[model samples]
Target: CAMASLWMLLVCANAAAALLVCLYLWLIAWPRWKRETRARLKVADDATVVAFFHPFCASGGGGERVLWKMVHTLAQLHREKKRSLHVVIFAQKGPKTPEQILAGAEERFGIDVSTEGGSGGGGSMKIDFVFIETELIDLLHAETWPRFTMIGQSYGSMVVAWRGFQTATPDLYFDTTGAAFTLPLGKLCGARCAAYVHYPTISTDMLAMVYSRRPSYNHDSAIASSKLASLVKCVYYFLFAGLYGVAGAFANVVFVNSSWTRDHIEALWRLSPAPTVLYPPVNVEALA
Candidate 1:
């Protein structure tokens, strides 16, 4: 009778332990993970947030121009449709404020981004800037190991994106820079992800060069000169390309800068909905 009682006690103990684990997962772990996912921004219940990942937000380059233009476009849509749309820019810490960045974009591009409720205008749409520290991203840099540079940076950007959106995730996650790693994280938070890829991380042309053992832009002096070096480099690139494709697969939609880029990305990602070609916007009047 004692042995049977002990056996029953052991069974009860196991059952209790299992129940505790389940309770922790439901009451603690899941909720904690949810809170961590939205740790960055405190979002309004009614607001439709659009988060943009642009590490070089202040840089008045082609990518920055696209970023600002997108903000302007959304602001215009918000005004026309009479909806509350908020734009959040995830960037590395810079001296400029969101207003300053918008102002700088105006000065550099000669485009009007002012909305009815914004500082520049009375537009209802607002732009918020979330700055990520370099230290967070520095851990992912592949400078020490040069061969895996693309994979390292891509993973680093993903980490940055994950943290950047943890506070207040957007309804739509748009990557102005070619960081496919951010897509999965955005999706995890129930955000639709899109990317404007300036160039494919790895192209068939690169693989072809490797396969043919031909010296191309990807093959430097050392790699091109030696057959063994070329073979090793080719294998590295092939592996990296596969990794890149997997990362890119997370994106719901992709927009390439040019037809050339579109073809390569389409071939690599093989996305069911093919990527669209969006030529970089040019200020016709400014150029004239």
Candidate 2:
């Protein structure tokens, strides 16, 4: 009788906690987010707003090159069309200003990004930065189980994107970092969503490694060597692949960097709308 009473008390406590969380989100978080988003990104009637999710904006890698090139291309398009386009980059706070990032991009890729509301050569398209602290992401990595790392990162990114978009949802949500988890959130916010998938989160090759009991990237030396460990990891990959497919499905449009990537994504994701292949942006002339 006492144990039954204790179980009921625990259930009641959990239910209360769930209710409180819902109340906080509905009453406190949503309204404040709406107010802040409107205040920060005051969209002009003529402007078309596009948000790019690039958490690692300062890491001037190939992906960063793609981002800068895309922005430049869009700016040129808007110029030709005589339309105002606002590009918002959701990034982590850094030592450099948006102007410095633009300068770095120009120096590296020879692409020009014009400054807005500043003393500089007049550039038509407006650029804005929405800085987010990445402590939550770091904490997720620290706290989550190793076997579920990929899924945790995917879900964590979705939460981060949700928070970032709370103030102002963009007309288009573009994920340059291959984090397809943000697609559903973007769609929820009424934005047309797209993702440039560098690679599928989990590939058939990864599954084959587990299936054949061979050591692979997904498994460490210890796990790969042990038959028992290999079997366990095979189950993990199977479940993760299903979850990844669900996340990829949320994308309204998908762009892949290469034919190899498109093949893998298509085979794995089975997305209804076939992915478009956009060759990686490389400055061959600059290199020459």
Candidate 3:
């Protein structure tokens, strides 16, 4: 009778474990990972599609300056009558239209992106703007997730990122902003991924704060004081740190803002060639 009961207990435990695995795949893996991707951006077959993933391109911020600068630089290159090149930016549609966004870039940052799409900058260069629902883009904002801001933003980015891919897949994917979550999506789509990161999603400083149980703006005092809560959070961060590193490694090139960022990305990414430090170029003329 004792042996039979022990056998029954082992069987029940195995069944419970199998059920949990099934639930995880059904709720998490299949929806987020197993879906197919499709592109909606239309372009000529021969043209090289270079897409910039900047959801807030019209914000007129420093990052927008950098984004438009690159776009303008490409526009200049297009004027040279070079090979077929199309620059498509993935942005969240706001009250402003795409044309308005271009005009704002010119007016605010003195960077112009108002080029003829069909004429291809008088050669074979073209520019286009893409967008999704504003709500999806809002996921990137910290305010969207009161709890687990880092993980929430990261997961929300994947939604935005995957949605962009479902709209269009570019030959080369560039993220002007620090949305590293999108890197893996580009990788999955067989596009070369690049990033200009001001900061990483998970950094050593964040780890130290959680480790030391220090309450700050990001860390709540309640969790910091409770040892069990702190330990739980530490585990969450530890697992997320692994995911962050894995996503970063998918990028072909990573450009950090400073040497400090370079050190962190290097340790996390573990790439063969270290990430290059690319400072944001100041528009001295506009600033003046």
Name the Cα RMSD for model 2: 4.7
Off by over 4 Å in 3: 1-42, 117-124, 286-288
The list of candidate 1 runs beyond 4 A from truth reads 1-44, 115-122, 137-145
Over the full model, what C-alpha lDDT does candidate 1 score relative to the true structure?
Answer: 0.76
Clashing pairs in 3: 40-167
Per-residue CA lDDT of model 3 for 1-288, tens digit only, reads: 999999999999999998787677446643443232112344555566788999898897888888888888777777676655778788897788777888989998877677654634456356677787988988989999988888899888889887876667677899888888888778666678998888887887888899999998888999999999999999998888888888888788888888999988887777524799988778777657
Backbone atom clashes (below 3 Å) for every candidate: 14, 1, 1
Please report, as a residue range, the 10-residue window in candidate 3 with the lowest summed lDDT.
31-40
Kindly give the stretch of ten consecutive residues in candidate 1 with the minimal lDDT sum: 115-124
Candidate 3 is scored at a TM of 0.81
Better of 1 and 3 by lDDT: 3
What do the candidate models score in CA lDDT, each in turn? 0.76, 0.77, 0.79
- CA shift at 284, candidate 3, in angstroms? 1.8
**Which of the predicted structures, 1 or 3, would earn the higher TM-score when compared with the native?**
3
Report the error of model 1 at residue 229, Å. Answer: 3.3
What digit string (tens of lDDT, one per residue) describes model 2 on residues 194-244?
Answer: 899887888888888778877655568788888888788888889888877
Every model: Cα RMSD to truth: 7.7, 4.7, 6.1
CA RMSD (A), model 3? 6.1
